[model samples]
Target chain A: MTDVPSYLSPTGQEIVFLLLGVVAVGAALLVVTTRQLVHAALWLVVCLGALAGCYLVLTAEFVAWVQVLIYVGAVVVLLLFGIMLTRAPIGRAADLDSRNRPVAAVVATATAIVLVTVVIDGFRTAYAPLEPGGGSAREIGSSVFRTWVLPFEVLSVLLLAALVGAIVLSRTDIRGRR
Target chain B: MHVVYPAVVSALLFSIGVYGVLARRNTILVLMSVELMLNAVNLNLVVFDVWLRDRLHSGQVLTLFVIVIAAAEVGLGLAIILALYRNRATVDLDRLRALAEFPVPSPEDADDHLPENATEETAGQASRASAATGPTRPPGRDDTPEATP
Candidate 1:
């Protein structure tokens, strides 16, 4: 029912996914390596936004929007607040990284190799053609409310507990100071 | 087009996260790395869920749960880190050995790194301690941490 681009069918979508993937991975790398804490958080925003784009490409519109709203909006903001409250080295932390760079790089590379190999091999033959309502909000809502209601309620409780725990832990004077 | 496409990307993202957690000393950086890893898992879950075409969309639902758990983890983790920094002056994981029961053994006490008389003094103490304390390792002697005047 769409008339955007006949040639844009698979080739165009693949190119978009590839571009978003590149952005996501590069930003994720920055989030880890940047000495400045604020910059690292900003890079994480880029990475998370790009992943939301990937979800869009995968035809999971509901998930894509939720990713943007929750991850990019709420989570990153909370992290930034945490950084500011903790007096993070926003300018330059010369000692932000330790002497384990070489070891960690080796471990990360090996894990990447193993994960890529296994996932690619296992899903080589699998494919999912796009459908109009395959992953729309209506569909996701149905699944969530019917088959996954209990876990959803549990998650709400977990969030509430986290909120209270954070308040209790961060307060300097538990009883007196305002 | 292929399911492996997003899966591979997620793997690479997870690897970057692993490196961040291992190499970065700042507790905040470590927390951010964990978020990255969780995002990677979310990507894979949604991709597979769509690929399998499960009517329940279990993968996406689970991703939702993971997102909540990540939020909770960050909240607690940052609070702990803040409390730790307030108690101590630093957040360096290597430098913060507070959890260790006994003080870490430093070569500074042994003086083995010293130029001359290194072995003579340490060995003398070693023999003396073996004689006094039986076959087990001897307590610190001349250069003993508690021996300082």
Candidate 2:
């Protein structure tokens, strides 16, 4: 068996994360700017896919896979189906403009600045280099099954409720007494 | 390795998604924008979880829950859009202005707002234009009518 490295060096990992981050951000911008609904969906897939890559680079392999399986694969497909079903005009709709673009921009920019400041300040005092070999799937699995059991069970119930809610909403004949 | 990379990326993604949600008029495109935002959050969670090196893998668990929730959201959202389309015959947001009022209208009354001519010509033109630019096939032009409703 190949020996696992004691630790991952911060430099290489940082570079990889930066690159993925750039890709994710750029794709997200495209998702917003694109006028066509289908084009927007396709760009969304790219953005989400790059995010999954970022997760992998962060050593959270299971989360990365879940991102791919759920966001890129399932959510996007459902959005496409919704587009087709609604027959939303494929071209740009005339009402895209909001009267409050300037206000929204200011708010968003302020939020970004504040968040950045908070994050940088929070991490200023402590710096922990990436630890190797701790985020393996087996370790994650055991922890979930053992210590996090209650939350896991609660999540399952949440999923069930969501499923039932979806079915009820989609049913055509809601008033059976007709 | 620092979590900053993923954090920054997720933040940017979330910002763009916010712009899309605020700017786009089409309901479908709006839904896509929401997906972008969710993905941004997922990236952040996974990165931080990895950085912390906690045994619980809370980030992965959270990501899983987000996925399930997103799926259900899209399903229900689509159903609502479909019901609206059946009644109004158009999904243009500008035309849905009255939706804000919560004013109830009979389905037959809703038909008055529909474009008078649901012509194949305009739909064909739209589809052709979209085919050149958009990712999926256009809505009304499906030759396979017997397929899923």
Candidate number with greatest DockQ: 1
Error of 2 at B94 (Å): 4.8
Off by over 4 Å in 1: A1-10, A175-178, B100-149
Q: Residue pairs in steric clash, candidate 2?
A: A130-B1
TM-score of each: 0.80, 0.75
RMSD of each: 9.0, 10.1
lDDT by residue for model 2 over B11-108, one digit each (tens)? 66777777766666667767777877777777767666766666677877777677777877787777777755654455655455554222244576
Candidate number achieving the greatest lDDT relative to the actual structure: 1
The global C-alpha lDDT for each of the candidates, from Candidate 1 onward, is: 0.78, 0.66
**Per-candidate count of clashing residue pairs (backbone under 3 Å):** 0, 1
Span of ten consecutive residues with least summed lDDT in model 1 chain B: B140-149
lDDT of 1 by residue, A13-82 (tens): 6679989999999999888888788999999999999999998988888888888888888889888987
Pick out the ten consecutive residues of candidate 2 chain B with the lowest summed lDDT.
B140-149
lDDT of 2: 0.66
